[model samples]
Target: MGLDRAASIADLRLKAKRRIPRFAFDLVDGGAEAEVNLRRNEEAFEEVLLTPRYMVDVSRIDTGTEVFGESFAAPFGMAPIGMLNAFWPDADLTLARLCKRQNVPYVASSAASTTLEALAEAADGNGWFQLYVSSDDTVTEGLIARAEAAGYEVMMVTADVPAAGKRDRDIRNQLSVPFRFTPEVVLQCALNPRWALTSLKHGTPNVANYADLLQSATSYADVQKTLITPSFDWESLRRLRDRWKGKLLVKGILHPQDALRCAEMGCDGVVVSNHGGRQVAFGPPTIEALPAIAEALGGRIPILLDSGVRRGADFVRAKARGADFVLAGRALAYGVGAGGRAGAERAMEILLLELQRALGQLGVPRFADVTRSALSDMPASQD
Candidate 1:
């Protein structure tokens, strides 16, 4: 399908599914275990209904907002996604460039196929780095120093993956970084010649940030043992805060107490996410968890929400429900997967247009005007 015809994020996702191999597609699209929370995240947003005021002047709608001492053109930004090369060659750089051009935040993941410095340069040093803390102090410290040196202003420590979730789709597909090519996988790639040839020309995707460390490792399991921090805790956050001088935010927080603790510990912000339902199968939808966290913090710090944010109306719902910003992961990834840099641009274009239209329909002049009063009561069954 043409980019112009792909009118929504859902359309981009369908295009992505047809463009890439099943294993690669599943990596971006699937959630953990039974994906109960995955479905619920999107469903819960429908519970929030906007009450529009008629005959209001919305002729000058402004989508601009500021976060982390930087002004963004919109309240929505790209959430970090790992191994985007599985979607397209240099997908991380493509997204960074897109965000830079759009003047939106782009959080680069530690597990990305491109280096942090490369992504930072692509984003004109405006990108944020999302670190997956390691149990090893030296490794963690090295990453922080690298991010600082690369001119990343904000550091987001992911706190939810105490252990890896059981993602059944990846298990069934036997997905790995280097891709263990079984006959089934090979045939799937063969069917998608464009993706296979592009990947062949660009080279296979690897965890670029951990390239040096993985050099001595023999298998993906060994690489995982050296990278992920199964014991990350509040103490770890404290130590990281002391070492990293830039803005620090915590991702993967769903509970109000955890959000409050991050603020009390001097975190600049908290992203109310469940890792897009990739880390926890039964966790509450981010929308359901957002209000309590917002109330607990009382706007002490910016609270961003991720997971299942598809439409512009969903963005308005999140803001009305107390999210300072919203992050889109699968939507952007799907765009890149479907049509490279152009596809990614199309995704952002669609979102920007949708946000503008949503605001106009709601008779809100700016995103900051969105409040709890805008939302109608949830249905009794939904409540």
Candidate 2:
């Protein structure tokens, strides 16, 4: 389907699946073992029903909202996605540019294919940086300095991934960084000529932010081992907050206690997430976790929701459930994979239009006007 015909994020996902190789698509599309949380994330959103009040001034709708003292055209922004180039070459850059043009925020990942500086330049300094703590304090300090130098105002430290999740799809497909051209991979690449040609022209994707550290790492295992710090904890967050002067947010927070602790530790915000269900299979969906965390924090820090936010109603549901803002991952990833920059823009356009329509339908003039009163009872879980 053409970009114009792509009415939803799901449509973009279908297009992306056809455009990219199976292994590459699966890396972006699949969640952790059993993917129960993955499906639950979307299912939970459906449980939230909006109650529209009629006879109100629904003519003017504003999707705009302020986050971390920065104004965004919409209440949603691009979530940080690692190895973006695995789905589409230069996908990180594409998303940065899209967010800049759309007047929204883009969080560049520590494991992005493009460097933080490059993404910052692409987003015209509207980019936020997501950091994965390193085993080496020096490396972590260097990354913080780079982000500060690049002019990123907000820094998000991912707290969940103490260990990597077992991604069965990736293992089955034998997907790896610096992709090994095994017979299966080679055949798959050959089958997807467009992606293959683009990838070939752009060269292999590497963790651009960690290029210096990855130099000595000859294999994917070496790269993984050198970068991930299994000992990441609250102390690590305190150290990061002390060293980094920018706004600090803790990502991958599901428990309300963790969110409360982030507030106690002086975090600027907390992203209610489960690493997009990539880190845990049975954890509660981020949507299901947001209200409790938001209540626990009690507006002490801004709460951003990620995972399973696919449509405009989903965005409204998040806001009504107490999220200050929502973030999209696979939505834009699928867009870039489908048709590069234009596809990315298309994805943003669909979400914005849907958001406006949802706000109007719910009799909410702006995203801030959405509240728990606008929602029906939460749906009971099937299982």
- Number of the top candidate by lDDT? 1
Candidate 2, residue 59: Cα displacement in angstroms equals 1.4
Q: Compared with the true structure, what per-residue lDDT tens digits does model 1 show for residues 91-176? A: 89999999999999999998899999999999895699999987677888888889989999898999988887788999899876
Clashing residue pairs in all predictions, respectively, total 0, 0
Q: Where does candidate 1 have its weakest 10-residue lDDT segment?
A: 374-383
lDDT of 1: 0.88
Each prediction's TM-score against the native? Answer: 0.97, 0.96
Candidate 1 is scored at a TM of: 0.97
Q: Evaluate model 2: give its TM-score.
A: 0.96
lDDT of 1 at 79: 94
Candidate 2, residues 107-195: lDDT per residue as tens digits? 99998989999999999967999998888888888888889888988999988888888788988998765567899888888999999
Q: After superposition, how far is residue 311 of candidate 2 from its true place, in Å?
A: 0.4
Off by over 4 Å in 2: 378-383
